[model samples]
Target: MTIILAWYRDLIELTMSSNLMTMVQPGAFSNLIQIGVLNLRLNNLTTIKSDSNSITNIQSGAILNLPKMRELNLQSNQITDIRPGTFSNLPNLPRLRLSSNHITNIWPGAFSSLPQLRWLDMCSNQLTYIQADAFSNLPQLSYLNLASNQIATIPPDTFLDLPQLMKLVLLNNPWQCDCRMVAFSLSSAEMLTNTIK
Candidate 1:
């Protein structure tokens, strides 16, 4: 029985890391594997699960086979955009890292299916605008980072729907501190005293 359990664990791990076509050992199966973790960081991937209309051939189902995948690290790539419903099937996805990419825009409902997602890291990108209601359905999201982008202004109600969000980072953005910013400054000053310092 112990040997059987060990084999099961090995199979699970193998399934999770199967989508990575980089450096797997010989005789490895690469599909329908349900590994708990999938880390494909720092690869030369220019797109994330692209589609037929996409210029790149990386389609949506590229990582769709790993159903048990809970965490995915796709940092330091050249991803420019994320199609809506790109990760609709991966129900257990809890954490996603997409930092250090070239993303410029995020379509609404793009991250809507990630019901269990708690943390999202999207720092160090070229994002100039975030469409309204982009994160409206993320009820379980707690930590979100939108730092180090080209964002100059935040649209009204852009963050109002995120009631469950506990920690949000909006630093390194060249914010235009005008009347709109004054309202934010006053509200932030009153809510979090650290804003004064």
Candidate 2:
């Protein structure tokens, strides 16, 4: 605990001085609502927060107070689960990176608050299932990368709300090219066409 506390305190000093922010925990910056960019990449973190750490564990409504946070990087962690609406507090968040994790499922409304989200990277994950309308909240989303995942099928209306999507990457997945898939592929093509033209 002392080591973690020292690390957390160092992060605050570095961030306040406008130097570089890394290896920092979310609870460490919970009170800094207007922080512009936060990067916690390659931290080997498994959970969003832990209750034992008094200085950095997120309290209730602590995340919601961060109304001005824009970019967050949590890539290369051991994160496996994302509680629904956990990210729904950052309505102004634009860029989010969750690549190279063990995420296998995405709960519905997981990104509901990120109305300004532009880029979302979930590559190199174990994602095999995504709840319906899981991405419906990100209406302004543009770039999405789901490459190197375990996705076998894409459900209907999975991307209905991503009207502003510019680039989509779904490569390297074991797609089950069956009847439903054929139909889904055709429908996806149509949807893309409609979105483009």
Candidate 3:
């Protein structure tokens, strides 16, 4: 269902948390052009993509038409997958919170839309494996939280493209500590130590 917010032209922040929203049609917020912060946490959203085939003619994602958005909160939802172009509209977005979801897979280039994104929180999810290029194309990312997931091992070059990354939280995962994890662990240890210092 489309939420018509065309009258509130000067609206900046919109909070619709804990509303039991199942799905948001594409261009749901197309009228909220000046909006910066959108909080849709604690919903029952399974997938951000709408069921309409017309979405292909527009944008293929949950959030659309909000160009000025900086912070998006979609935590505590039932989201399972993050497909490519899911966030293709929010170029200026800086922070995204997807924690406490049922996310198991993140398609490649899922986050390539947010060029200015700096902070990403994906803690407390069901993520088991992450592709090496999953986190690529994020030049301004600094803080990433992947704690409390089911991930055991990730590729050594998983964080290679994130030059500005200063903090990475990977705690609470059942790590294997095998040869494949040696390089990543050593580098992560150094990064964590430097962050502490």
- Candidate 1 Cα RMSD after full superposition onto the native fold (Å): 7.3
User: Which residue pairs in candidate 1 have backbone atoms (N, alpha carbon, C) closer than 3 angstroms, thus clashing?
Assistant: 15-33, 16-35, 50-58
For 1-197, candidate 3 gives per-residue lDDT tens digits of: 54567788789998888776776666677678899998878878765553221111112665776789989888888877887788888899999998998888988888988889999999999999989888979999999999999999988768878878988899999998899899887876665566567
Give the lDDT of residue 138 in candidate 1: 82
**Collision count for each candidate, in order:** 3, 0, 0
TM-score of each predicted structure versus truth: 0.73, 0.80, 0.87
TM-score ranking of the models: 3, 2, 1
Model 1 over residues 58-169: C-alpha lDDT tens digits? Answer: 3344455456777877666566777677666667788988788778887787788788888999999888877777776787888899999998877665665565677889
Candidate 1: residue 4 Cα off by (Å): 24
**How far is 91's C-alpha from truth in model 2 (Å)?**
0.9
Judging by TM-score against the true structure, name the best candidate: 3
C-alpha lDDT values of all predictions: 0.63, 0.67, 0.80
Point out where model 3 deviates above 4 Å: 50-59, 186-197
Quality of model 3 by C-alpha lDDT: 0.80
lDDT of 2 by residue, 7-123 (tens): 342232112212122223545455554566666665555555421211111223324445677777767766676666667567788898888878887777777767899999999
Number of the top candidate by lDDT?
A: 3
Roughly what TM-score does model 3 have, to 2 decimal places?
0.87
